[model samples]
Target: MRLVHVVTLVSEDGAYGGPTSVATGQLEECATRGHEVTLLSLWRGGSRAPAHIGSVPLRTRPARALLPGRFTGIMHPLLVGDMWRSMGRADVVHIHAGRDLVSLTALAVATLRRKRFFTQTHGMVEPRHRLVARLFDRLYVPLLRRARGCLVLTERERRAVSEVIGPQGPPLLTLPNGVRPEHDAEVERGPRAPEVLFMARLHPRKRPDAFVETAALVHRKLPGVRFTLHGADEGELPTVRRLIAAHRLWGVVSYGGALSYAEALRAQARAAVYVLPSVDEPFPMTVIEALSAGTPVVCTDTCGMADELARRGAAVVTDGSPRAMADAVCEVLTDENRRAGLVRAGRRAVAESFSIHAVADRLEEIYRNL
Candidate 1:
């Protein structure tokens, strides 16, 4: 099968976060299955796009912000041609779409060419009363109705997308983000380092500041405990730095810059606990990656995966507050038994429910049906 996957942006250090990671994982899995996979995307950072991922081919066009709002007005001039060629030749096109120009253009070309395509928005496309969101919806929602199906992460997301695309929209399917945990088996698991880790983009929604605050609070209780944050900046690093400085936690809370996907897993492997203070996150890939890495996970109760993770005892769900998060971190740090329980349950939950092989199997079925 010839499969084409499209995503909005590819940065030097994966600043765009989960959508890019998820798409790459899916396409690589497809490539290993003997499918001719092509990944088309807009490249940021002044460097060249990589040649390929495993056996899959990659095509990228440089992105430039020619107008207002860095991402909203960014344009990838030559990407439409790439989209036309790859999506036109594809047996199925899977677009990791958003309301941005790149994704909207991909949808337009795919629809205009009458290609068999599916869209997975990664909680990006949702109903909003904002003027920009309203405008973007008017442009893309009709195109979405022509899709074979739309994939969502949670029931909340499904409902939001439904409102955006309306009653006549395509079937909405809930698909879990898949992960590969084979490398986790190799981790030395006697006692992890006394480190609390947060890995995600440092955006306002991600709450990197909260991580710093949590670090401050945890330090008061457990002075030996260290906190590390690794993520690309999305206008929130300044706030995080300020909070760290204000709290006088310069060395205790180190800010490691953005990291590659492999590097993130390695960081998780060494950490005593992984914490994400972000709220309303729709199945945060980082939390699941932490789980797969055998790091006891701590995330907010409002994330899409919170209920299942809490029910399975796979993670400690918090209330998106530094105090709650710090308490959770402290508990995981002080109690060896509880920490071990979380690690065991987290790895089990990921293998049984969020394995990449199972996700690929479902994707294959969907492509065949299309």
Candidate 2:
């Protein structure tokens, strides 16, 4: 099978988060299975040429500002041309983002060429603002409807997209993002420290402030607890810094900015508990990585993987609040037996469902049927 994957950005460091990670993992797995795989992405931070993830080929174009907004997608004529050419040669086009301009361009080309294309909405269709939601409904919803199939991380997201696309929208497939199998071995070795770690972009949506508040609450209960916050500052660095100072958590809480992929996996392996306090996170790769490392996870109920993890007894799911998150963390920290059980369950869950090889096999079936 020849597959062409279209995404907004491709970074070795996972600067753009889970979507990039998912794309890289899936393409590599596809290539390993002897399927021809090519990635078309916008290169960030001054990448000149194509890079490879294993045998998969990644072609990128430097990004340029065409739209005016914080989350608005960029434009590159060369990328559009590249995508069009790739689609012409590929058996199927797999688009990774829904609301971006690159996705919109791919949709147009696929429609014009009458090609079969599948779209995976990385939970981008549900905008926070009413005005933006309305804009997406008008402009992006139709593009989604044109796909042969649409993929979502959770059933909740599928239902939401179904509401917008009505009865005649493209069929929605519920597919969770996957983690690399190498992390599974890390689960055997026990955590090196009694640390609670938060790793993601320090942005408003990620709720780094909530993590800080939760840290303070957890520290009040477990005074010896160490909290480490990792990831590059997006826009909420000042807010996180202010909260850390206001709570006087300088000694208890420390910020480790922007980790490499290897550093991140090592951090996950060494941490006792991994927490994601973000709201409406659609299948966070961090959660999967943490689980794969046999580290117990505490995340908000709104996270896409929350239900599945809780069902497997792999994590403690809480409401998106500091008090609730703190309580969940304390529960994991205080009970040695519970923590061990969670670690066991988390490793089992990842091995059975979220491994990249298994996910790629399922995806191959989908592509063949299409």
Residues 301-361 of candidate 2 have per-residue lDDT tens digits of: 8898888888999899999789999998999999899989998999888888898888888
TM-score of candidate 2 against the unseen true structure: 0.91
Expressed as tens digits, the lDDT of each residue in 1-370 for candidate 1 is 9999998877787777899889988888888889989899878775677877545677988888866765666777788888888877888989998878887888899988888999999998877898877877788889888899999989999998998899999999878898877857655555678999999888888889889989999999999999998988888888988888899998899889998766777888899889898878998888878888888999999999999999999999988899999999999998989988998999899899888888899999888876
| Candidate 1 vs. true structure, TM-score | 0.95
Scored against the true structure, residue 16 in model 1 reaches a CA lDDT of 78
In model 1, the runs with Cα more than 4 Å from the true position are 185-191
Per-residue lDDT for 180 in model 1? 78
Q: TM-scores across all candidates?
A: 0.95, 0.91
Candidate 2 Cα misplacement greater than 4 A, ranges: 46-50, 127-139, 186-191
